[model samples]
Target: MPALNAEKAIAQEKAIIINTESLNVRNGPGLSFSVAKQVHKGDEFQVVSSENDWYEIKLNSSKTGWVANWLVTLKAGSSAKKGTVTEDGLRVRDGAGTNYSVVAALNNGEEVSITEEQGNWYKISAGSIAGWVHKDYIAGDAPETEDSETVSNVQPDNWTGISTDNSLNVRNSPGLHGSIIGKLNKGDKVSVTGSVSGWFRIEFGGIEGWVSSQYIEKPSSASKPPANQVSYGKVIINSLNIRENANLNGKVVGSVKQGEVYEILEEKNNWYKLSLKGGKTGWAAGWYMEKTVAEKPQKQQSTRKAEEVQILYNGTNLRSSAFTNSAIVARASSGETFPIKKKTGEWYEVSLKNGQTGFVASWIVSVSGSSDSAPVNKPKSGGLKGKTILIDPGHGGRDSGTIGYRGTFEKDLTLSTSQILYDLLKKAGADVILTRNDDSYSSLNTRVALAHYHDSDAFISIHYDSISDSSVKGYTAYYYHQYQKELSQTVLGSLVKSLSSRNRGLKQGDYFVIRENKQPAVLLELGYLSNPSEEALTRTHSFQDMAARSIYNGLDEYFSE
Candidate 1:
């Protein structure tokens, strides 16, 4: 075969890295390629080419490599002034010119706080090290000292955190050399007092200390509502349960009566903290409550047109941006109306009752007095008739996934079952697409890209479970967010009812496919391949057919509702 020319297929565009963690720059456009360098969050690069979901990036005048497109944001304009280093071991000097003594060696993608500038040299700080770097290496906005915003020292209230790692050391200070005063085990609750840099100060077991914020499960700044933004939430569900914390596993504090309105304090991960009637506060699931419009003073009707739209789907997400991957700012229920500010492609920018702006999908809502609005009465067609579903088979190619006791390859089983599902859904008049048709290698990013490109209504990732304990045997469905919980429950319920297996019920999993997927996505763990009995049954075609039929029935029920 002739040598393949990779350079001929790239698009010239400017992009900025968005991944919070460091991303590797590879020699080629796939995972099989070797890592040439690394790029940190806030770094910018010129896109020299593109292949599938990967972009060939121009790191510098002498370096070029490929990076995953999902990790970067593509934009058209002048790049930001602040940025990160693109290559490892870049020298951080005491002065801007090359003659300056080296103060520190910065790693690839390391973030720097820029302060002053002198010609080609910029004064910056990486962690505790203050130094200057050459202008050619930086990637974001380089703002002058006077233009930069000062950091606020305001602390949050009633914040609780859970330790994610075992024997997490509690220190007296925020840095690594801080004195270790105590330790906390995994899942241990700590009352967070404040934060400094990337460290969180906590009071655990009466001992006040600091811990790396990365290992604690606390509400991020992005999840919190804007300051001084107050809104009222009307409880819609009968006896809505309120928890002491944001998660589902948090202790139940009390219950709110249906139709009772409460002042909303904040929002985190689709949960709202409400101030109850008795001076008590607790978190309530956002899906069960609707934002009630506060009674405004009566006034004469004005001639201004009411630019409003009503939600058509229950549990619809109101995102911070027009993209599905953006953080969900709030959740809305069916029949709730919001005034529109503008439109961006398939999303409508709307003003919420809380005085905040968010974007909602255009298809799931109907605009008042507009020709683009969907009919008030939904069509009677089968839910899956014209829906696009993306079926993803877990592992393939060089990856064998989990091996069963009966020598069954997980990749093979997943592909076989997905193929059957593809056929069945296709026969039902649904536009179904498979992530992989054969035993071919596909990256997780590729799978997600396929779902977005096809505008899929639902994404199902199929896989078999394996563990050291052979006695465990059950079917579990997993979802990442509250909005996806219904889909998971419906599918898992049908599978358990149709097949002879233990129903493990719905689980909140953090798997990549389900977590990163923009559409209603679920990962189904059919049965435990480690169990001898389950492995034998999973190898049979009857079980696969039954599972496919159950999923089909589940989709029908989910969409019909």
Candidate 2:
């Protein structure tokens, strides 16, 4: 049994309309704090959260600020949601607490309409009865219209399948109008409980849920990878969209660039669901991706002084000796990682998974560990090597940026991502300088001063965007000076190649740091933190690595030009 606790609960969906002719949004809840942004009368903003007599609202897609509650009118309550009872004998009360009278009792598998939510309780109505119940007993997700047409129920032969979407919604019923109770990530295995029309009812989040049949793939010996082995896919096209659904009508979620490799999660009609980085997954046209049958070598126990290496390109031939003329032992697939026993001239003597030794071209494969830990190919000393690069992690200390849907702080995300980018540039032999290494706050003027003081070759500011509209997503590049335009494009272009999110392209911005700096600079709005899905993706380590690698590659390309 769960109890109601207002302090720890997530903010409900709500908005506030500015009433005063002009209202100044402050940095904090009090009037003593500095103004963060300004909003005119009649302007409405989504309320992120509320404090004592103050409400936090979205100023833009990338930042948030606080406004006095007295100057704005709170909008109507949150929209209704459909729910299904997960437990039997759930008590429905007249109010939101145990002290209230019991109105009714709900059984498992019963459906209800959630009209309002208060703390840990939900005001639900089922048929004629209506009352409050503990939210823990009900599985509620997305909103849905009133169900009218009877869903056609059927029985299917297959009972097990893999989800083919990055985040496949699991509905309470069998149709698009059904209430969403959970989600399935790319390659998640599901056990079918029932079937209806074009949907399959499966056990999701320990509750009965339905998912589209089109994105579910049945397992088999021929199509499935070997036991304890994974599959990889190589993007053959210049660019490929990772859509929300497998069909062309689906919305674009992310993208993959040519020559990039990702692990295959599931396969559908002419489509392949790929595991990009971290927990992000999406479907790409299988025709544009070459399916590579390869897996990481099974864990080895023997004490061998060797570092792991992966083939960068598919169908690379493993030679008998260090020379190309040597007899071809085997062909390696893309994304397959192996251990290198020794390094020969222009070749790596690798130990294959099948207990065989062969030599592969060094240029075609990438070493796994850092420079000192592995035989990494060092930079040519002409690109980013020894270049003074300054990284500014936007917002810190009391000045947190945007607030995520899940209550994630924008300051924390920027700091962590900056650390990753800093390490990558440092490893590449660049003289990387960070505006603030920790949670301490630095004024915008101070940040810009670092660039001029160091004669920085490039200054890059990192931030995650947010806005009132959750639907708006993707990465954005901002630059003020004309010279910064090229730098913005170069960095953003490389970033789009590696990111799974949308390509928002570059735009002119007038921010204090980039506008005052004389050196080449660009501020990157990485992803929409306000969007629940994009926020989760940006917080992953793989996402951070991809961002850093792309920026480094972009700087390298810009210098080479």
Candidate 3:
């Protein structure tokens, strides 16, 4: 009866293979034993006995060897479980148990397709390594083999999506039990073809597979404009803020500089919806944008005698109206000459070589033998007259500072505003000195030193603020000392009144220029570049003019006090 029992046990023993590239077969169940032979991946052997983490196997008719349990898998199963390695460097052995020889290793989080199960072991194949792992270290569900004949015949759609999970399995069928064929990382885009149950049929890296619908997201419908529409608008502000919504408190997404042109989509309330380059869309205040007229084909020269005009600026917009806020038809570079049809107020109507007719700013063009138009200069205000003021425009050169969504640079805005303020202050008769007059770099210490050298009555540093949260918008004034706080408050209050933007209020800050300067110093965050609305507003000439006037008025008030 005992011999019969032993025969039955032997009959139940199954054939297995070296699942790794090379596996060592040893004479005993422990690492201390001598190696009997090396077997390559897919080499088959019969299981004879198991002890600890080692498997005693039959190599041939006359030999038996011990292999690490994790390195071998049962050769009979057509399906297995899907799992992932829980820990890094988990060893793959040549048998079902650890006492068997080591065959390979698995990195943490590595995915595997299980093929069979035995006792406390699961057979798996991860990439180039096929082996057995202890059930305690794997996390997965039972695997289901796919029958190609049973695949759904649903045709794919044109929708696209992105994977939301850090590690998502792509299976051959649309279910958790299906065989995993690939993997996707978080944010990976896929072409969704069909859907079944809660799974999406997708094409990833040229492989068609199924992923859970819960982990996919469709692209935003508003990210791009509809095809074939071609309406255009011009940015009227030096830096016009673009917002996600058409409201005063909407989040800022980007900014567009004065002279930039964009395609207009729709207008609502006081905002113009613009289709920006690179598949982006945003809304800007309609009050700051003007519709651009379509370019007309250049007309052939005829007997209607025309006057010659030369472009005076490097890049001057040729518009289709007599108004400064009109739509731009083309750009005329400095030294470019054109035939003038006539002049209206401050704009000159010109006929281009391309047969197009447009308007150029009268100030940016010179008519042959005509006297230059008088510049419209602002009148001087008396209160700030004779006060020595120091202006510091923050950031320059390689330090671009914050860049808004529409590519408006904080450094550029600062310089533009500072120059405007300098003009306004100088016109008011204040002795003013600028830390930087161009796109150049100056260290914080250098700015403070210049202020001291000038012995200025007040030092004001201009800057734009940026934050990770794009929703934040407003203007803030900062002072490092108690004596400067009142100045900060006065200036900030005037700014809020002038620009009509949110008042971020005054705060004591320890900026180097403000803290280190001996003279009364203040730093102003004109607006948030991260906020689309504020960014656009801050970049406008009207905003800059308002800001400059506010600062001048604040200085006037401070001196009067």
Candidate 4:
């Protein structure tokens, strides 16, 4: 929470790169240093000294690399600039000049700096920047007053020695390349227990780990609070490169969203094995998710006019009527602004600047004078015009019901196929309900609840079959409740006829989604995941369309009866 001013002199400082590009090193102003290795944009570095356009920096520990001055900026605020506590907090600006952009504002007395001055703005080279703060807002810049007490007692002995410049590696084991976990940034404090071949055995984020001594600085007696401890109670989505194993080149499963909550069940090295609230468990790197709430600007005047609403997506058209078939009068691009004149159902009558009036789906456009926005159409389809079917893709996140042979996750395949099917149904004038759109992990309860909540006429779960035998192939329909038997049979027959693979036939299953679903529900295993040939074919456009057409035919047949 300390203000990071670029100019505030501190015994130590760390620069965490936010830009997702590398900082290329070039020999120039300070030619006295030998440089090696490219500094990836997000990599953190320790500031040893700065003169002119070149900075003498240490990256990932042992190596002394000269970083280009502009690519990597520093933060400046510390306790000394304002007697350890000033009445006003510092601001973070984009650049060291007055005209720089304001990246973030700070609370009063927060630790940050007033490193230098360019015109009216004082540069606080900290985590971020603040631009053009009034002189009155500036606080104490005088050196440490006599009243400044030595809080070194709060500092752990030799803990501060672990700087970001060390070859510090968070690993699954104590030795080299043992699943390199998290990268240690400059000024990161960790309690050292032992050392091996320039590797420091340190306790990191409540887990015992090893960091290369080359990347860490010598321990300082100065005490600062250990970087905020990870709170285990709240859930966090993994935001960094999360792999199956804790290795650098490990295959990425997927990234966890920032600010997502997860329950921490265990910790090893720098990996926090977490249990998601949705009953899914996964390992995540400790360095990625920061646990801090930033205060956002709440009082800025409305930059947009009350009559203008921005378009959410491109190809948005103004139709004659609220219906999708009302006939397009005009098309709007993404971010186009328009004024709403009236509302009919979920559609809005928007009057364009050229005096043309037509209806737009309100969900796709935001109200100009208000902060509210809505989706153009709610996923819930009310009209059962052609065929009424709810396609629920099961087990989002960790509950991926089954895994395919070629490493195609069930969650992904189901959602992909469901989307194609939904589009097909829509184009055919069939009413459809897709439980979810994106790769969000959802629970079976939620999936079933959605179908019943929408009063869907029928519910079908989409999935790819997986088995130990790579030869097992073809589509299969599963029905639990007897009411869904007729629908399942019809869909199954069409799938077997439409798809070229072996027919698995319709069978009864106690699948949780179908058994508990309030509406008539059936689960479909469209293809075998273990069969490589089938897997490849299942992923094709032709196969997806065939599956959709088959399902539609089956629905039509069932409904006709």
- The TM-score that candidate 1 achieves is 0.36
Mind giving the per-residue lDDT tens digits that candidate 3 earns over 66-143? 876645766544454467675567788776665568789987567888777555677778878887777556667533
Q: Which segments of model 4 are wrong by more than 4 Å?
A: 1-387, 397-403
Q: How accurate is candidate 2 locally (lDDT)?
A: 0.72
Measured on C-alpha atoms, candidate 3 has an lDDT of 0.69
TM-score of each: 0.36, 0.36, 0.34, 0.36
**Model 2 quality (TM-score):** 0.36
| Residue-by-residue lDDT tens digits, candidate 2, 1-561 | 112124532346787778667877878664435578778999988888776446778888999888766456666365567888876688999976565899899887798988755545677999988998877678765323223324443565446787776447677777655555555655566777667557777765335678888898887846745553555565645588998776667789988875456767776544568886668988876646544343342222124345776664569899899998999999988667788898887688999888999998764655655253212322333788888899999877555566576545677678878888898889888899999876666756568656755667889999888766778899989888887788899999999889988999898875656766667899999998778789878867689778888988898987767
Q: What ranges in model 1 sit over 4 Å off?
A: 1-342, 345-381
**Predicted candidate 2, C-alpha RMSD:** 19.1
Error of 3 at 468 (Å): 1.1
Candidate 2: worst-modelled 10 consecutive residues by lDDT: 372-381
Cα lDDT tens digits, model 4, 1-561, are 112226623325644242326544533222222235556756766666554334666654565556544445454434324311222344455665333566776654454545533333445534454343433345454323311322232223333344554224565444332345466543444666665544566766556666556676664457534321223321223245556655445567666553243444444444556655356666666565322111111112247566555564569888888998779899988556777787788778888878988888754554556654222222323333554678986545334445454344566567767877787778768778887765455545456556644556778788787655677788888887777787788788888777788887878775556755546677888887678788767766578778877887777666665
Candidate whose lDDT is highest: 2
What is the lDDT for 558 in model 4? Answer: 65
Enumerate clash totals for all models, in the order shown: 12, 3, 30, 60
TM-score quality measure for candidate 4:
0.36
Cα shift from native, residue 9, model 3 (Å): 82
